[model samples]
Target: MRTLLIKNAKNIITMDKDRNAYPGGSLYAVDQQIVAIGNDIPYQAADTVIDATGKIVYPGLINTHHHLYQNLTRNIPFVQKTELFDWLITLYDIWRCLRPEDIYLSAKVGLGELLKSGCTTAADHFYCFPNGVSGELIDEEIRAAGELGIRFFPTRGSMSLGRSKGGLPPDEVCQTEGAIMRDSRRLIETYHDPGRFAMVRVGVAPCSPFSITADLLRESASLARSYGVRMHTHLAETKDEDAYCLERLGMRPLEFMEANGWVGPDVWYAHGIYFDDGEIGRLAHRGCGVAHCPCSNMKMGSGVMPIVKMLQAGVSVGLGVDGSASNDGSNMLGEVRAAHLLHNLMHGTTDIGAEDCLRVATMRSAKVLGWADDIGSLEIGKAADLFMIDSRQLAFAGALHNDATLPVLAGLSQTVDTTIVSGKVVVKEGRLVGVDEEKLARMAQAASNRLLNEASLRTKIDYGRMRANRAYPNF
Candidate 1:
């Protein structure tokens, strides 16, 4: 039985029931679970000791939504300024060129970025499968996460509606609904684990409303429930999606999802920007969760989510970095900062603050993913999943004026210096310990170029048509 001890931190934001902050506190872990947390614990010999005198410790950030594959296609020139539907349409051809190696390389690059930014738990929505790519794509991501030693929740995302069937994606990229369900079941049976300190888990994600059939949604939810895994999907991200569901399905997006068994405690939706008060109440009542992606929503002109309203109504909300292609970066710290700014902007200065944003990124995010009992907070008997930020940095030079209460405030004032997951140090001194960042960057760039140059995809992309087709299709 291995043990690790973290001693003499500047502060430890426990994020417990009382939201306590322990100054000059120490925590001890045996195996992968935290055994004790307080000012000073009785000495027991340990294999590892992290002296974090100048650092602040908190629960590792949890990312509730992301398209890790999209890291390969970030900041493409043509689609940089487009809205949600237009952006997806313009890049659909590019995403079709994603090979298994591309997925692996991008997952490494993206996960490395998240780890550097203090994110230890991440959920990746990898829906695109082209050229007969199997669930091996998800296996590659899981392999990367295991090598990095971070906790991962990879959703088996599927798209079953093509442009020929009035969907957003082309026929080559979309699969049959029956095949999607079968593969989803296969992925859950093979990957999902409910145990504490689990390294990898699976989620059922049926892409988005416009790219998948209603039948797929219902069936996927039923299958996920049968396997006791969680369900995720994109919902009401933009006004266009709102109009589409209202006109086509004779109900708003949330109402349509309810008709198809998509609402519950086990399901969470990404970029819930256009949900109304009634819909928010429905979500809160049913224990449904939302993965709030503030930067992506603002970048894509999807409007601000009523996050404050949702929280006030008792909805479970978490922070998401969304897709790197849309947000153009995978910095989880930046997502927390954006969440702070956007939520305050939407509700007013008094409603949402830095602590609220931090909670959304850590404990609240764990709740959204249904992993709160095991990994969200720094509690005895919980998994030792947390990160440290050096408060000595320039960002917090004058910010630690209130020494005892400073670390909680410094959460918004500094970047992560160390990221620990399951009692293992995955990042130390602000660098990834498990992989070479420079090499991963080079491989990611090469893969991005190859995706852009793929013949079948390059021939299908019509940049001129994308620019000319400005007519918003009637919902």
Candidate 2:
């Protein structure tokens, strides 16, 4: 058996039932589980010891929504000004050109960034599975997450309706309902583990209401509930999306989703910016969760999610960095800070305080991912997944008194000093263990260049210089 001990931290921001914060904290664990907490934890022997002096400990952040493959497409100059629908249309072309190797490399690069930002578990919504691509692309992501030592919840995302069927994506990028359901079941059977501290859990996601048929939505929900797994998708993200749903489905986004049986504890929607008071109450009453992607929302001009209202109504709300293409990075700590600022501007106060943002990122996020019982808080009998930042640094000089809330409001965005996941130190001294960081960065950029080249993408402004020799496509 393996034993690990973390001793004498500056603070432990435990997002437990009591909302506890411990100073001069310590934690003890054996194998993958946390055995005890605090200075009085009984211990006889130890295989390893992590001296966390001058460091602030936190429950490993959980990212409830992401498009990990989009790490390769970050800041593609042209799409910077585009909004939700146009962004999807533009990226779908490039995404459909992806090979299995691209998926693997992008997932690794994205998950690596996330891990460095103190994210231990991430749920990647990968919906773009190009035709004739052999082997499970999601399997590539699973393999990459294992290599990087980050817990993963990769949804079998599907797009069934194409432009031909009044949807956002092209036909070639969409799949048949039968194929989507078949693969969703296979992935859940092959990878979804319902046990505590599960590293890999799969979900069934039919992309979104506008991207899939009503039949596919209802059936996907049934299939996921049948197998006891969660369901996820983007919903009501923007005014354009609201118009699309109302015009096409003859109902508001939430009504259409409710008609399709997409309410209840097992379902969580990404964005969720357009829901009203009645809808918010409905979500809270039904126990459905929301993955609030504030950075992506601001970047793409998507409306602000009513996180204050959601919390007031007792809805389960968590934070997500969204697709790296929209967010431009995978930093959960940054996401928390953005949430703090966004809500402050919207509601005009500290109604959504720093402690609240930390809870949203950790405790509520674990619940949103359906892993609440095991890995959210720093407590005994939980998974030993956490990150530490050296409070001795200048960033936390004055904010040290409010360590639990400081991470969200301190405006500090450096990588954590160390990160431990499942009783193993995956990141030590602010670097990933056993991984070549510089080499990975170079390789990822090379892969991105190859992908853009293969997709025939070029700068948008090159066409206006009377340069018909280079035809740049606008999406």
Candidate 3:
């Protein structure tokens, strides 16, 4: 087995159950698992040793929600200033033109950004498929993750309702409910590995409340249970979603999910900004998880999630950058920083601290993605997934002098110097190890242009019309 050693770190925030922070520590890894963690682990037997002096090491950030395909459409001027519904309507046509190359290029670009931001494990919810694409899209994403050496959970997301059926998505983008279920089963069987140090896993996601029928929700949950994977969906993301569920389904978004048997430890909801007090209690009691997307929520004008309340109520909550089109960036550090600032703004100054936000980004986020046992912390026998940030950078030049952990807490604006997933170094010196950055950026740009130029998408940009129609009888 190949052994690797990382020695002489300024500080290592384990984020383990003990919440240990080791000063001037070392870590040893044997083939994908951590063998030892403490001060001064010997490196004589290791094949490679990385000198991590003047750097901060932590459990790699976990991103629990993202539409990897959305990376290609970031910063589109027309949808930049729109709300969730209007933004979707404006971008749906563009998304409907996605091809296999678009999916691959976008996943590479997005996952590259995540790695640079110190994320090792990422969960992407890609629900849009057009032009007769099969599970090839998910396969491409998985391949990209494997190539980059990032631990990934790519949800088999599907949307079964179209505008013809009163759903938000256009008719061409929605699939038959049966096809969605079958593909979900196939994906799980092919890729859902429950073993430690799994490079790629699959989850069953039926898109969102407004875009899928109730029957599909119940069936998806049952199917996910059969395979023992996980379930995810969008819930209570906005007032419009709440109103839609209330008017059509005769219940709020959380109530509807509970009624449909979509609440449990093996499930998580994205956004969750509009949940009420009772809903929060329900989630806590049922052991549900939430992917808190502060940047996306702020960008799309979706209300702030009650993160402080959720954490206090025992709800498993983690950070997500969400879709790139909505967030306009895939920076996990920025997401944590936003979480820190937003929670403090929502609660008091002492309500949430930098460490707490960092916990959500690392350990809590891993728990939500069902990978806590193997990769969430720097512990013996756990997967060696972690990242290091150079404390000597301008962002942390003076911050590290006061406190060793202060740089991670306050230096959210910087990039990680090194990112390792499963004992393999995917990034060193703030660059990807497997792919060329310039080539990847150029391919992404070309793919984006090709998607945008599809003839079928030329007339799909009537944002005013969609916003005007947003008030149409709530369902």
The best candidate in terms of lDDT: 2
Q: How far is candidate 1 from the true structure (C-alpha RMSD, Å)?
A: 3.4
Q: Extract clashing residue pairs from model 2.
A: none
* lDDT value, residue 279 of candidate 3: 87
- Model 2 C-alpha RMSD to native: 3.2
In the predicted model 1, the residue pairs found to clash are none
- Per-residue error for 360 in candidate 1, Å, reads 0.9
Per-model lDDT: 0.85, 0.87, 0.85
TM-score of 1: 0.94
Per-candidate TM equals: 0.94, 0.95, 0.95
Worst 10 residues of 3 by lDDT: 463-472
Backbone clashes (count) for model 2: 0
What is the Cα-based lDDT of residue 174 in candidate 2?
Answer: 90
Write one digit per residue (lDDT tens) for candidate 3, span 242-322.
888888888888888888999999999998899888889989999999999999999888899998889999999988999
lDDT (Cα, tens digit) per residue for candidate 2, span 1-475 = 7899888888888899898877887888988898888865676458989778988899999999999889888878656666788778877777877888889889998898888889999999999988888538999999999998999999989998999989999898899998888888889999999988899999988888778999999999899999999999998898988898889989998898899899999999999899999999999999999999999999988889989999999999988999999999999999998998888899977587878888899999999988988888989899999999987777777776678877776636674888889988998888889999998899888988777776664433321122222134453
Candidate achieving higher lDDT, 1 or 2: 2
Model 2, residue 84: displacement in angstroms? 1.0
Candidate 1 structure quality by residue, lDDT tens digits, 1-475: 8898999998899878789888889999998999999897895468999888987898888999999999888877667567888788867877777788888888998898888888999999988988566647888898888888889999999998899988888887888888888777778888888888888889999998888888999889889888899999999898899888877678888887898999999999998888888889999999999999988988988899888899999999999999999898888888887877776677788898877788888889999999998887899999899988888887677787654234444555337788989998999888899577888898899888778767335676543223333344331
